[model samples]
Structures are given as structure tokens and as C-alpha cells.
Target: MTNYDSAFRWMKVKNGRLHFASIELDIQKNDFENKIVDDYLVNGFKNDSEGIKPWKKGLIRGLEFTLSKSSNFWTIVIKELQAPVLDSNPAIIGYTAILAFIEKTKIIIDEDDLRKIELFVYESWKGSNADKVPNFNKLIFE
Candidate 1:
């Protein structure tokens, strides 16, 4: 059992350009409705029995950018997260070519680690520099 063990679900499309919008699975509708009230984004996996420390948010692990079609994504131009180390491999490049897998799985997820991954994946979609992403799009609800 690790407090740093978390998973995320996200979606993306190549409209004018490739865009990514990822959310933690534990996130509820209230998470979206209340987002405006307070800017707090929560990552639900970092609070329990991870064996070590279990509470130090910094000691946890999480996701990183997996892929992008943009040339800047790999060729050392965008050395954001794992880009510096993971880009040299053709396998990783292949994983990124199809964006669907990246949408759901974070390469790494730690307990309460969703927020950091959210900032990297979700908040980027919210930026003025990026395209607009609706809180709820094609994802179905019951």
C-alpha cells in the first residue's frame, strides 16, 4: 500500500491543435461546481496508508506529460517534465502518437497526487494560451 498510488482520467482532441483535459477519478460533480468558490483542486490518493510518511504531499509521486504531436513536445524544445530523460526512446514516442491512452492513465500517480497532475494536465487546458475546455463534455453521466 502506497499513499502515492493514484490514477486519473482525462480526455483530449486535436482540434486546431492537440488539447488535453484530465481529471482525477475521485473528483465529484461538486468538485467542478465548487471550483469557482475556491480554487482548491484535490488529489484524493495522498491521505492514507502508503507505508511511508503517508502525509507529506511533496514526498508523493504523480503523472507527467506523456506525449504530444507537436514537434516541440519531444525534440528537447519542451523539456517540461520527463521530456529531458524519457524522450530519447522510440517506445515513448509511439505511446504519445495515439492520445487516447494518455487521456486516462498518468505515467505516475501518488495519493493526493492528482492535484499536481491536475495542474500539469487540467490547469494547462484552462490557461489563456491553451484552448477552452468545458468541465463536462462528451463524458456521459447517470
Candidate 2:
């Protein structure tokens, strides 16, 4: 068993209105509701399926969300980012765009933030199914 097998506490966006990943992800759903609504992003919602006219929007938003999530990886290659985006674009996808917009500025979070994120993830990693055989909750991530 690993420490992640049991996440005692978590710090999350509160209540940002995700399409619904796992119920456990919404620890402070009400608190971050505004942020969530504003971001209005999701993940894994690919198009070419769903057959719904509105599905494309969701798919695009999900792709953005996925890109944003991947942006955190840039923190490891901090030096590669230029300068303009260093101040803005906290989210991963936004940072990528910011770099594209700016001529010379790339973005990278410092080691401290990376460590914090790492610790947060470590502390957040509860087992998939530990409490009950079919515990059907806690899969939501905000």
C-alpha cells in the first residue's frame, strides 16, 4: 500500500462545474463554482463520436483541459520557456497559448510550485477501490 492509497486531505478548485469525472473530486464545489463556470473545461471528450451537435464544443473544451493538464510538464523544462508568459497562464493550456501569443516569452512554474503540485498529487492519490468492493465514488477530479 502507498500513501496515496489513502488521501486524508485534499486542496482543489472547490466547485468548478466539471462535466463530472468522479464525485470525490468536488471537495469544495461551491467555493470554486465561479472559477469552474468560467473555465468551463473538461477532458477525454473526443469528437467523431457522440453524434450530438453540441458534442464538439465539449470535445474541444476537453482537449483544452487535457492540454492544460499537460502544460504542468513544462515546469520541469523551466528554462525552455521565454519570458512573456512567466507571469500569466497558471493553467497548463493557457500557458501554451500565452507562449504562442508572445514573441519571446515562454512560461514555466518554479520548482516550489512543482513540488507543491507533486505533494498535492501524492496526498490526493487514494486507491481506486478500497473502501467497498464496488465503492462507486471518488473518481471525480476537479
The number of the candidate with the highest lDDT is: 2
lDDT for model 2 comes to: 0.25
| Per-prediction CA RMSD (Å) | 17.3, 17.8
User: Model 1, stretches more than 4 Å misplaced?
Assistant: 1-9, 12-108, 131-142
Give lDDT: candidate 2, residue 86: 19
Q: Report the error of model 2 at residue 95, Å.
A: 13
Write candidate 1's Cα lDDT for 27-115 as tens digits: 12222112111122223233233321211111111111222211122211111111111111111121222232234323332334334
Question: How high is the CA lDDT of each candidate model?
Answer: 0.23, 0.25
Candidate closest to the true structure, highest TM-score: 2
